[model samples]
Target: MSVVEVREDGPVSIISINRPDRRNAINQQVALDLQSAFAAFDASGQRVAVLTGAGEDAFSAGADFTDLPELWRCIPTVGITTDKPIIAAVTGWCIGGALVAVMACDLCVASESAKFSYPEARLGFTGGMIAGLAARIPHKVAMEVMLLGATLDARRAYEVGLVNRVVANGRQVEEAVAMARELAESAPLVLGTIKRFVTESIMPKGPSELMGRATRELGAVRESEDGREGMRAAREKRKPVYKGR
Candidate 1:
């Protein structure tokens, strides 16, 4: 089975982390799968996406302990560059790297049973992608969650601007999908412009986020058709015209 699952709902695509056995914990393979799933969504006809985990027990227990991923590679805005909006439907525990991913999304919908935490400071290790949370939400609240490892329940998360809406546990995905459907009906160009403006011009990026964006852009160039053409031309000792795709 795929570590991540994708299913389309007209203009909205639901991308799920299919690891209920691991509580949707993100390992290296999960991270890579997520990157591929979202990249495909961005390039497809889907105008919006709702990202969620398989079960209601936990959106994610955070990064897999035994096999920690380069978690940044799955985070929105960082690893993937798309102007299309992503709405996170969170239920249960959204901790560590999970919190980082949700905060980067354009909007978040959390279930009443949901809980958000960032315990990296206490764990004596961090990827530092969560630092951008301070710029997204209130600094004190971000500091409390990151530094003191304070847990924010759904209600508190909504109040602190960590989540856009709070709903019943099982309704998180439904509500998020409804929201995405609404967005899908809007002018795609306008939505894309505003999203790009806010994320690129308004939001501040942390070091890890900056690095992730850099690598994603470079990888795109390396994987482009023009890149392959150039390589093939060099091998044949002939000049090649580039399509600039």
Candidate 2:
């Protein structure tokens, strides 16, 4: 089966992350598939796209750590521009780079069991992963998520405006589809125009550029003592020891 599945339901196109065993983690292929799905949705008669994960367990666990540096650098919609409207239907464990995808969506719906976090700080890099957090949610909430690496449940995510709706567990996909259908009922061109107008004016630049700049300026950080130490600790399944490095 394909790692990413795209199906059309009349005017709504549903693009699902189909890696349940890995909690729908984004890898190089997944990233490419997601981009292709979105592009198809944009080019088709479909008026809206609903993004979700397969199974009832997870929306996405984030990027596969094993695919870091190279593959992890290419995230779907992170820095690219699109005129289409995509809605996120989150179920569970929407953490790390997965949250970045969620932030990229125009609207988001989460199941009660859904949880979110940004652990890239622990991995020792900042810009490429979460450049959209502050723009999507409050600065304080963004800071807490990125710095403290704490998990935010569905209710809290909704309260902080990180999610548009919070449904009961297992109902996220249903609710998201309903919302997509509703959005599809509108004039497609007008909706697209509005989406572009608002996003271009308010949304920050593409995350790819920001991350590219970050990777260049922080090249030393990747080779720093703390960077190597953090990787070692993670490999050994222990807390990382950071000694001013």
Candidate 3:
């Protein structure tokens, strides 16, 4: 069976880590499949993607210990970038590379039963992407999570802004799909433009440069047919139909 399964759910594509027998751990095949799935989703013109694990017991227990070296190399270098947003639907436990995957996503919706940690230190392994940890959580919290190597519950994750929403166990995927569907129904170009703007705003650039880029992007959007439709739809009190212009 495939280590990862990709399925279409309307405008949202679901990419599931399917190695539940191993707690959905990341291995060589899993990494390749996931990379392929993401690429396919981007090329398929899907509006959004929901990434999850197959079983209720874990989102991913991290890298398969037996293939740690391969995973270490593959995790960082391989993965596709998609213009469409990706939502991580985390359930059960997340650790190591699993946490990395979720952090890479645009949004994260986690189940209340979910737990997170990076125990690499305890195992004499170095952590991946220290800068990412610092960027995602408060300084002290990020330090504590990494240095202490303690698992945190989903509620704590939400409080730290690492997770967007936390729902009851088994509801993470459902909640994420609902959010994705809402996004998919909206103007795709607007969403892509906003994502680009946010990304540019965070880059190391002067205010003038950032503002210039934002102004140009906005001007382009404002001149598009979708922009006119958005206004017309507001006037008509109905949803806008955007053709991705």
Q: Report the number of the highest-lDDT candidate.
A: 1
TM-score to true structure, per model: 0.93, 0.80, 0.78
Residue-level lDDT tens digits of model 1 in 72-96:
7899988866899999999999989
Residue-level lDDT of model 3, residues 30-132, one tens digit each, is 8767877776787887899999999999999988878653342222112345567889999999988788667657899999999988887888875454336
Off by over 4 Å in 1: 225-245
Model 3, C-alpha of 226: deviation from truth (Å): 38
Clashes per model (N, Cα, C within 3 A):
0, 0, 0
Query: Model 2: per-residue lDDT, tens digit, 2-33?
Result: 99998888888888989999898888788767
The Cα RMSD of model 1 versus the native structure comes to 1.9
Highest TM-score model number: 1
Off by over 4 Å in 3: 69-78, 200-245
Which candidate model has the greater TM-score, 2 or 3?
2
Worst 10 residues of 1 by lDDT: 72-81
